[model samples]
Target: MISKRAQQLQPSATLKVTGRAKELKRQGKSIVSLSAGEPDFKTPQFICDAAIEAIQNGFHGYTMNTGTPELRAAIVEKLKRDNNLEFDAAQIVCSNGAKQSVGFSLLALIDKGDEVIIPAPYWVSYPEMVRLAEGESVIVRTSFENNFKLTPSQLEESITEKTKAIILCSPSNPTGSCYSKDELAALADVLRKHPNIYIISDEIYEYIVFEGDHVSILNAAPDLKDRVVLINGFSKGFAMTGWRLGYLAAHPDVVTAVSKIQSQETSAPSSISQKAAEAAYNGPLDEVLAMREEFKKRRDFMVASLNEIEGVSCFTPGGAFYVFPDISHYLGAKKPNGDTIQNSTELCLYLLDEFGLAVVPGDAFGEPDGLRMSYAAAMSDLEDAMNRFQEGLATLTVH
Candidate 1:
């Protein structure tokens, strides 16, 4: 029998929506998909060249379980240069993308029944990771009016003695909400009072900000450096999601503990991918910058266009590639066939079936009656997807 853990865990809802869209395209249907979470751009040539070179030079053999010393040093340098945060290489551990780093962190730190405080709408994998680690996922809801940002008071209210850690994501996945320095300082104040609570700050979308210098929770209060685990990677920035290279920076003891999980589970990230990641750190960052500008343009257009549709309210995000628009006006709405739109899933399916547009329902991200539309596709596709979505919403009759 499959483990109960595996049975209970929800499949990635983004991929589920994306797969259906792909199938429709394969079946010769005209589809407009905004469900993808990855860059449409190709991996930059410099990173690819390094990976090819590594493979040719016999990098197939596994090296150290944590990572090659050179790659670890490169990540340390990149973090310091890009985020203005300093950390020793001994405080870092390489893993198979940010997912593994998060998974390992939970596995290493969480004991059964311990609570992990997460702000919603979070990346889809977070709560599952906490549950898989035998920890309780204590989710704090964020509203559409604030672009889904969590207030310090809301975070404080969620805390209890059983709270072991807080999962923080900047340029957050579902809503693209980035925290300002002052905002992070507010959160830091809450953490400072709780010495035992660790902060797992996920900065995977660091380089894709639309405006303002990227702010990190760790940078807000360097005094709590030992308590903050900084998670990041080459995926969103360098268009290197396929490479699966990511790492974490924390206290030496925490890194060593995560390293043990890495050693036992993944036996370290792929050697070739690590080499490619080093190139991402050392090579030109211009490609990623240009891509960020393009995404911002698309994000602005999509947010505005979605709001033009009747019954939709969108918050223009400050970072990341997703725009989540509230569709709560359609809840309890009657369809053409008389079935009421009770929640996001039914609404999402209605759009997918009738208009051939694919969007992940917000329920998967801890918000119902909203849909996550990714601007990760080309502008042409973005324009088409919004048109179809507008038509789809027109089919519903709501109060």
Candidate 2:
């Protein structure tokens, strides 16, 4: 029998759609996929050259459970430089990816039956990671009017004695909604009252902000540094998703606990990848900035095109590559064959199977009134996708 923990988890919804779309493409279908979560750019050449130098220098052996001394120092410097957060080398732990960093942090902090508060429309993996740590997830739904951010009042109301932690993702996946400094300050005020709760700030998309500068919770609440596990990686910003490198910074005690677990589960990340990530931090941000500009163009076109479709409303996200458009108006509508699209999942599947456009359902992110479409592909692909999106919805009729 499958383990109970394995049984409790659902396969990643984004990967599911992307996988199906790839299969259709293999069968020679012209599918326009907007379901992937990674940047579409090639890994910046300088970073790749750094990895090549590492290989030539014979740095292939396993690294320390935490990370190489050099990479950890780079990450420490990055935290101070980019996020205005100070950390020592001992407080940073590198892992296979930011996803693993989050999982390890949850395992280090959460006890059985402990409740970890998560805002709705979160990255699909957050609740699953909490489950793996044998903790309960307390989901607080944020409204669209508020850009789906967790309000201070909501944070306070959700906290109980059993609450162990909360996850915050800025330039969020699935929604692309970012939390401003003022907004974070309000949430920080609420968290200040709950001294026991930990904050897991996932800043994987930190470099892709299209609005004002990206702000970390640490920037707003320096007092909470010891309790914050800041998760970041080279995946999105550096276009190094395949490199499988990410790290987290926290109190030494938390780092020690996570290192202990990682030592057994998986040792430090790849040595080559660590060297490359160090170069990424040390190198200029020119390529990252250029990618951000292109993404902003795609975001503008997508948001505008999605809104032009009757009954489809899209929020202009400040960062990240996804646009979560509200499609509730199309739910409960029927196809010409008289089949009803009852939820976001069904609507998305219909778009994929019939219209050859693949996007993820908002149900996967704890919201059923919307669906997420990635604008990370070429501008030409985005235009094709928008056309297919409109044509697909026009086929359905409401009662």
Candidate 3:
């Protein structure tokens, strides 16, 4: 028999659906995919050059288990410059990616039966990671009416002696909602009441925000800095997904516990990657600004187009590249092929097979009546996907 943990784990539905879409694309189909999560931009030339230089310089040996001192120092400096938070290199642990950084925090902090409070319509991996750590997830339902944000009262009501941590994702995935400074402070107040629970602020999309400015929870309540483990990475901000570099800025004890896990598991993030990441954090500012501005334009275009479609309503995402729209109006309707689309998943499948446009269904994000469409594709690709999607839905008979 398989281990009980293996039995309990469900596969990532988002990625699973995406793979199916990709399969169709590889089968000589002319597909427009709206299921991407990464930026359409390529990694900067300078960052790649840095990695190549590191390899030539023989920076290939195993460095510190946490990370190289040089890389950690650069990260520490970047945090100070961007977030106004200071931490020694000893407090940082560079991991393979943001997922590992998040997983490390959970592994270090969670005990069996302990609960992590996760807001719904969350990133698909959050609850599963908690379960893998043997921690229960106490799901708090955040609503579109409230812009899919968790109120302090929701967190307050959910806290208990068994609660271990609150996982916060800003400019959130799927929904692209960002919390304001005042809103983050409200959350801080709730956490202050429950000191036993730690906060893992996942800021992987920090630089991708279209809103006025990013308000890091660490910046909001500096007094609670020690209790907050700030999670960020180069993947989204630097368009470096394949680089596999991410880090956590946290209390030393937490870093040490995670480092121990890394030592036995991954040993350390790639030596070359650590060097490239250092360059990413310390290098030119203009490239980062350009990427952010482009994403903003794309977000605006995608949301506007989606909103214009009949029977579909979408909010302008504050950040990130995804538009989550309410698609209940089309459900229970009949398609041109005479098949009835009863839910979001069936609707997504209908679009994929009929119009050759791929999108992820919302059932994975805790909303079965909506669909997630990513604008991370090129502008032309996004335009095509939207048009095809609209036509696909138009073929459906009104119920």
> What are the C-alpha RMSDs, in order, of all predicted structures?
1.0, 0.7, 1.3
Error of 3 at 11 (Å): 1.9
- In TM-score terms, candidate 1 sits at 0.98
Stretches of candidate 3 exceeding 4 Å from the true structure: none
Instruction: At residue 260, give the lDDT of candidate 1.
Output: 85
Q: What is the per-residue lDDT of model 3 for residues 53-136, given as tens digits with 9 covering 90 to 100?
A: 999999999888888999999998988888788899999999999999999899999999999999977888999999999999
User: How good is model 2 by TM-score?
Assistant: 0.99
**Model 1 segments beyond 4 Å from truth?**
none
Candidate 2 lDDT, 1-399, residue by residue in tens: 999999999899999999999999999998999999989999999999999999999999998889999999998898889877788899899999999999999999999999999999989999999999999999999888888889999999999999999999998997999999999999999999989999999999999999879999999999998889999999999899999999999998899999999999999899999999999999999999999999999999999999999999988999999999999999999987999999999999999989999999999999999989999999999999999999999999977
> Total clashing residue pairs per candidate?
0, 0, 0
Give me the displacement of residue 379 in model 2, in angstroms.
0.3
In candidate 3, position 147 carries an lDDT of 76
Model 1: number of clashes? 0
Model 3 Cα displacement at 344 (Å)?
A: 1.5
For TM-score, candidate 2 versus 3, the one ahead is 2
- Tens-digit per-residue lDDT, 1-399, candidate 1: 999999989999999999998998899988888898899999999889999999999998897888889998998888788788898778889889998999999998999999999998888899999989999999998888777888989988999999999999998999988999889999899889999999999999999998877889877888889999899988998888888988999998898899988888878889999999988898888899999999989988988898788888998888989988999999898999998999999899889888999999999999985789989998999988888988888888897
Clashing pairs in model 3, backbone N/Cα/C closer than 3 A = none
